[model samples]
Target: MRLFTIGFTQSSAAHFFGRLKEAGVTRLIDVRLNRRSQLAGFAKEGDLAWFARELCGIETEHALALAPTPALLGAYRAGEVDWPEYAARFKRLIARRRIETQLDRARLDGACLLCSEALPHHCHRRVVAEYLRETWGKVEVVDL
Candidate 1:
């Protein structure tokens, strides 16, 4: 199985959708704690769903189960918790949720995990991908 990860912070509409198309992403799984944001522009929940369907012929599904808890995100952003701690806690959350079993494995084959960060390195989407990869062997992750 193959999974892709991407962030919209530094990507324009063209660049973002273009990369998805290039990756042959069949579905975009939004993993943001807050999907609706005025500052998200084209990446806002409604707009992104519409564009993914109309422009790229890709499906969009918002998976709140994949997002960090609001308090965890707050603590991390407030610098109360460091990246390593945040990452550890997020991974544990995923385990507790048993997200791997709950997720549709078929849907993940060509799916991309979406987040707000511009880079995948520090994003929870990467952690999600890694968790899944570890659980489901032979899984390949492409950071977009």
Candidate 2:
């Protein structure tokens, strides 16, 4: 399976959509906990859905299962936990949710995991990709 991850922050409108189109992404799976936040700007649920279809002819799906739990996010943002600890707990959360079993391989083949971070290094999207790759057989991940 082929998977891609991307962050909307620090990216211009043109660059974000262009990257997805260039990568041949057929679907974008939003992994953010809050999909309708005003801070999202062009990345907001409604805008993204429309832009995706219009600009790239791709579909978008929001999957809360891929987001970090509120408590986990709070802890990390509050500095109560570091990246490694936050990552471990998030991985455990995925395991507990059995996300692998719930995943649709076909839908994910050309899908990109979406988040707001500027990079995947400290993001839950990377954890999702790594966890799925580790437990669900071979998967090629590209951080777009």
Candidate 3:
């Protein structure tokens, strides 16, 4: 299964949707903890859903578990969220456990992890992608 992670921090809804279409993303796992945000286009679940449907034909779902868990916060404070170690633990949860069930549902159509960050390398999606590579290999990450 090919997996993708996409960022939406810097792009307009058009650009974001376009990237997803170009990547042939059939489903988007909204990984942001706050599905609603102060950001203009991203502030509501229904709106994004509508946009995705109307513009890109790609389905959107919240990847609740893919968002950083509260436990990850405690680890971050203790400096445990550093790349290698956090990536290991996060990979196990996201790729090998119940979280995979959620991702799998998304992937039934083709899926990518989505976050508000515009840069994939700076987001938790990067960490997840690393875990994906270590375990699954040869996946693509598209910053929409």
Candidate 4:
């Protein structure tokens, strides 16, 4: 299965949706702890879902099970936890949650994990993808 990951920061709406379209993303799994944010603009939950469906014909679903806890995210944002620690904790969180079983395997075939980090290098979305690849095997993870 092919699993893609993306971040919306520093990207225009046109570029974001365009990439999704080009990637043939059929579903967008939003792995964000908070779905609503004033700064998200076009990437806000409702707006993003609408645009994804109308423009790219992509289904959108928010999977909080893949997101970090509010405390963990807050600590990371507050500089209490570094990226390494944050990534480790996030990985453990997902492993404990057993997302490999919780998420439908078929839905992820052409799905892309969505976050707001602008890049997947330090994002939890990447961790989630990698975890799935490690556990399930044969998952081609592409960062878009």
- Go through the candidates in order and give each one's C-alpha lDDT: 0.94, 0.95, 0.68, 0.94
Considering only N, C-alpha and C atoms within 3 Å, which residue pairs clash in candidate 4?
A: none
Deviation of model 3 at 116, angstroms: 0.7
Q: How close is candidate 1 to the true structure, as a TM-score?
A: 0.98
> How well does model 3 score by local distance difference test?
0.68
lDDT for 117 (candidate 3): 72
- Per residue, candidate 1 scores C-alpha lDDT tens digits across 1-144 of 999999999888999999999889999999999988899999998999999999899999999999999999999999999999999999999999999899989989999999999998889999999999998888899999
In order of appearance, the predictions have TM-scores of: 0.98, 0.98, 0.73, 0.98
Question: What is candidate 4's lDDT per residue for 5-90, written digit by digit as tens?
Answer: 99999999999999999999989999998879999999998999999999999989999999999999999999999999999999
Give candidate 4 misplaced runs (Cα > 4 Å): none
Query: Mind sharing the TM-score for model 3?
Result: 0.73
lDDT of 2 by residue, 36-127 (tens): 89989899989999999999999999999999989999999999999999999999999999999999988899899999998999999999
Q: List the residue pairs that clash in candidate 1.
A: none
* Model 2 bad stretches (over 4 Å): none
Q: How accurate is candidate 2 locally (lDDT)?
A: 0.95
The alpha-carbon deviation from the true structure for residue 126 of candidate 1, after best TM-score superposition, in angstroms, is: 0.1
Clashing pairs in 2: none
